[model samples]
Target chain A: MKIERREFLKLGAAVAVGLGGGLTLDVLTKTKPAAAETRTDVAGTRVSSKALHAKRWAMVVDASKFKTEEDFRRVKEACVKAHNIPDFGPDSKHQIKWIWEEPFERTFYGVDDPYLPEAIKKENFPVMCNHCENPPCVRVCPTQATFKRPDGIVGMDYHRCIGCRFCMAACPFGARSFNFVDPRPYIKDINPDFPTRTKGVVEKCNFCMERLDQGLMPVCVEASNGALVFGDLDDPTSDVRKILDTHYAIRRKPELGTGPSVFYLVGGGGAGA
Target chain B: MLEKALSGSRRYWAWIVFLLLLILVGFLAYMRQFEIGLGVTGMSRDVSWGLYIAQFTFLVGVAASAVMVAIPYYLHDYKRFKDIVIYGEFLAVSCVVMCILFIFVDLGQPMRIMNVILHPTPHSMMFWDMCVLFGYLLLNFIIGWTSLGAERKGFPHPHWVKVLAYIAIPWAVSIHTVTAFLYSGLPARSFWLSAIMAARFLASAFAAGPALLVIFLLILRKVSSFKVGKEALQALAKIVAYAMIANVFFFLLEVFTAFYSRIPEDMAAFQYLFWGLDGKHSLVPFMWSAAVLALLGIALLVIPRTRKNEVILPFAMAAVYLAAWIDKGVNLILAGFVPNPFGQVIQYAPTATEIMIVIGVYAIGLLILTVLYKVVLGVREERA
Candidate 1:
């Protein structure tokens, strides 16, 4: 078997190519069944109950109804309690926030005109993770730890997150928080249902996917009375769709092309008007 | 060859011991950081990346700078650089090791570093950066080791070695370019989003990398029998001077575009760095110092008399090295986050622990460099 150098090299290259191709095919095929199952489950659930299955989750906050500080506090408190987010107190430099308050101007800085209504200008808007259709945080995450779920909710897999904080840097809204310290000690009352995060890894609002699975509204939405509305944006009949259709609403940094799901209703003015 | 590093003077042993002590201190600090979290550092939610990342960015430039010597020597057959090219490669090897360490320490979950490889997101610049950095490290190691061995044997390097060296020329440029892309592609941070980022990075790297190389050669001349020669040093000085000029020019261009446009978003970071933005002026003094030093360094190098004077040359190189380090390693990353996405200034200063960790990484790089230089010099001496 006298094989020339050129022929031998050609044979080696072919074997390498064949092995690489076979390995790629194996990897693709192995993951297909799990993905297919999730897809089927989503489709089956959608067919069984139109109201239960979310194609795109979204939220709307009515600034007019959220008049008092107490009203805003309740919504924040509910979210914090539901998520087991640590409270580093008022003085802590690096506090964890699943939901927090920001002035209206700061919340929608670029969009807001200088001639904004005085009432809207002074109001403290409750801001949280927007769960965008095109999320920069998800794009920058090396691990798909923070990802968009089938329901269009941006989900955080705390266990899988390497806590690189690239997502924190990538999030335009400052929506994500890193567990700079052990979050467990700071958490006053641990939620038995929700697991507390470790000293590393990022955490953010998950749109209450767990609660939704149990046929409950997001804790923030439930606490907001009629101020906060949550529903499937893909469903034409959903409350969020109806509210968005009928009212004048704004999403944060829409120009950034993130397609934020959280909308603000600033139409019914009080002080400036 | 391995025994060469082991047989060194008392000064060499002392230097090695000093680096070891620093490494021990850094290891202890890192242990504390591991037990807690990245919270031990001064980085916050607003300023997420801090000292570690900044150092990583700077060292990557230093690593990429090896191409300055490699290109002139290998591609152009520039005889002057032939003796010193291996030193540049060895310096790159050390810089890369430090860069990798800086990144590892910066990670919130250092144990899960392999997730980057397992997940392999093409969309993420970090994924690409990891690929290039590791590839560049391996390429330099193979080329440096193989070429040096061939030189020792008085034989021409294998054909494959030349092919790898050619591949390395473009690969060096790509490493820094990819690093710039990591910041530039982000839409959220207006300060980093610029077309000139990669170009600016390359210019700075070419200046800083060779400056360090020249400094090392000068030290080697004094302590050892290794002669990098007068012509070699002068040629390297020319490269450093040109690159430094280009780097400063690129930075001035950034300043002009930002201030002239008067887009508050664009000007915010520069304003924060040079002046005080919203009363936060921690970085103001350092940035000014960097600018002044850079100008003075360029002035010294541009003048032939000052550049050629051996006594004046070291000072000029040191000034350029410090200026570039301050600009890239300290100001650049910090300023990018300032006037953060929400147009607010949240100041960050590295903790004692963080600084110690940085010092430790540097010590490790120096130790690696010293050992590598010792071996290469020994081989060359024996052959001579």
Candidate 2:
């Protein structure tokens, strides 16, 4: 909630002076008069487009409920539909890349291997884009195609992506994907409302921007089978806000200081299960 | 035969022809890649960087190797280097030519490379890399030409030539270091996040680049009309030996630090590459091969009898080059991001087109080196 103004100033000063009042500054401003009233499934929150960007979007996953494959698949489908993303058959080269299902028992290569919860005998968390506070992808992109929104969501300007994929390399998470071939071949039915990417552009989860634009909850949140909780970290009254406050939610790569928006609840068993 | 051996043989024509044919095939492959986009390659989401980048990293060492010849001729006042210094400049020219080509095929839009000058990202290391590579390329060309022209006219090298020659030393260091910054600065990939990445890159470049140059020199000695005495190459090889030793030591230091510190996040990457974390065994052999090659190269260079043996030295250098190239390139760069942040492991292999682009670029470099060497060799033969 407290975006350190001093830290922004320090980073901004070292950067090009021409980049004045970018999306970060837009975060503090009010939304347009029109989009001020809309519904999000999270209880105790009604906000405008201005309010949308004012608060950084974040997710809290309660890994306890993700005990079944059905639970994980339900949320994955929901997120995909909400984004209007086409998921081609497995092994299809043109498969529309989106959300990942990480096995629960996994540890950061050499990092901690915490005790496996009883329920998560075959555990892992579903991961999308973290929408990092400091995105390396945005930094390395020569095209400036992938920029972060004011509310801490990483947005893509598909029109601008020359598909250089430097962002793909710069990203530590491997969160980004490149359309190596023509994506249209795989896009069986085009979603006119939500656009598809051209070949040679890099893409990843947009944190369900299309849904956010229409004042609806991200499809992943609705599909999460009570596993995923979405909320504004700035607002203490919201359900996602409440979840983060009540339970000990874990953020990925806490040391990286990218301020990941996705949170994980514990669950999952030993590896190779 | 001895007189011709002292100069350099006509076998240069055969190498030139062979490289040209490879380059032609490579150009055809690149055209196909451009038409189809990168999908022709094995790259997917999990494995982002593949062969193009690997070749770029390797040839960059070749480009940086020019510094060996540059320093002795321009700085240390080693008179013996005069005969081969043009070859050094020519080698840098070709390697850089190849470096730029490898990158050209890797880009999504080759035309957009011009954006570098237009956008001018002062903060981005990539921006700096572009500037350094071009500058290094131009500087080597100018220095080599002027030196060759002076040698032809049977006059002492002009003073203005030394200006560019001296600048090439630190400039050589900058190209590879800046390339290192391309990766080491990325905080997310713990494998490339080490503080000594720049030094490690330089150490590895020193090890591989000069070894390549030494081998090339020996081949030229045997087949070419040009002649290089042992003293000049011994000076270069001695330095290469130390660089190889340092490179191996630095690699060990990273291994020690990763394991000793027990930073699982960092170690996880090493485990995936070296010990096959998550039941994957793809990159382990390449990693071990590089380690073994590094040791063998050091052994050859360290021992006087083996080091002095022409047959053994060239063979040793070849082995060292392969090892270091794989270490800095394929495994070090690609395997860093396996299983991605989302725990999805993606595998990558370069397509034929990707390999072709690599070859084409080498062809272009060879073309440049060939012409430059011809001009220099002509003058040297006349003078002798």
Candidate 3:
């Protein structure tokens, strides 16, 4: 398509500004590597190589192991407490759920059959940000505030977000949440470690990058008692890769071709059918 | 030049005063929204967009409608539209202003709206939309002002102005197409994801814009001595008829594909819009009314006798205007959200504050129209 001279000039200006903003963001987010330190566990054993960079982060939740509502609630509480996500209880319209529960039918909505077994149909699955390889939210973000990191984690820069809600609309999984009102008042006990979001900006699960940086597993994974697997998918030796190779796990809305990193192992044959 | 608009009758001043009052009330409501956030309005996480974005979508078509008059007068040398073309451009100018205001008010971080400019992502359709809208606004402003100035001076319009007019013809189509692209490209909303969205948008715009123009021109004819001849109105009615037919046909194409394919995701939105999915029928009556009105409007305009009749022509144009409005402004955006990603219904209805802001925005548009028309009429009357 041939653009008029004036239109071209306007576009040029926009590109120039975009480049400038990109440089600024890079400078602001650049962090020191924490002096290449090694950490020891409580029993004085090395748990992980602290300086090792994850090539691709992924999560796999075994649905059968999450048998009780209390099991799901513990995971939710850990994520919420760690992230300082506000509680807007029972008001679904205003509620901000980073990771929440859904029925098996709703979780695997389009793929699931109507006449599935009652036990399978009644199962509740814990859902969160899929951290898609090709995230629609990142693609549609006007400000680049929501982006897919090199580690296959979809990240949000709340400070840079313009609050257009475009990311919220673009997320097909409904993973993103907009702070419709000031979230501070509703937050009963703010976690000092995590920063709370202001009203208007969109937010979602960030795969707990902060916890990972400190050589710790994500709070949800820790709370799940071996039910949830978290590891570098790029590493063939990682726990997630091992599980994917052995088990039949499905990602939500895989037909959309987003290539979601989060996988679910429902175990009982007809859960996906 | 602006002094001419200032020198108007008592009725003109009264109208301006009324618009100012509405604007004041809207401003107050906006202040409240600014403090609290979009939660002050009816918009939820499910329905992220509501009245503000809807009006923005509708008025973009209104702004682009000026092309209907411009193309006939400038491109085809249709002299019948000569006197009224300025009004069309002026209407477009006002509508564009209103469109900008709607977007501004809809923004969560209104202050950071400049980020769209500061950190533009060309991949984002919204960024492209912003560029084209601002460009279109500038094009209309320059074309309308220069042409009106040339007319006031009693000189032949310059060669450059004609070139710009030609450029504007396609640019007008691009503005609406780009606006449609803003919705269509999103894979998240099945209701908006379609190849024909831009074509459908242009068809609806071609009908709605011209229809609104005709109604405004008829009103001008009664209130003032600004005469848009019978032949001109008839020709416009014909354009409206054909465009409305295409628009309705495009909509039906969507319906046919959704139902025939039996794709649950594709059919879900339409079901929510027409019959209400899972007991959510908020937009059901409105969608049905718009469909009926569109049919009636098409029938009225398609018949030559009714189309040519002055009294009936206004009714026909009104029907076309309201039908397109309800279709685009009310049904389109809401349907995109219902059965949201999780396949659940979350209803949305605008609060009083939201409604008042909409009214205020319309009043602002009318106020601009009144002032611009006053200037155009004064210049024409002096020449006469």
Residue pairs in clash, model 3: none
TM per prediction: 0.91, 0.84, 0.92
Instruction: Please list the residue runs of candidate 3 whose C-alpha ends up more than 4 Å from where it truly belongs after superposition.
Output: A1-52, A268-273
Q: Please give, for residues A137-187, the per-residue lDDT of candidate 3 as tens digits.
A: 898888898988778889998878878888877888988888989999888
lDDT (Cα atoms) of all candidates against the true structure: 0.85, 0.73, 0.84
Q: How far in Å is the alpha carbon of A208 misplaced in model 3?
A: 1.0
List per-model TM-scores for chain B: 0.99, 0.94, 0.98
Binned by DockQ into CAPRI classes (incorrect, acceptable, medium, high), candidate 2 is acceptable
| Interface RMSD score of candidate 2 | 2.8
Question: How much lDDT does candidate 2 score?
Answer: 0.73
Better of 1 and 3 by DockQ: 3
Where's the lowest-lDDT run of ten residues in candidate 1 chain A?
Answer: A24-33
A1-273 per-residue lDDT for model 2 (tens digits):
666654564444334223432222121122223424343324222333343443778877777667678887888776555444655567744355567676654423333456644445456667777888888887887656678876788988766666667788777666677777767666555655566666677778887765565466777777765567777777888766777666666777778777788877664311112
Clashes of 2: 22
* Residue A223's lDDT in candidate 2: 77
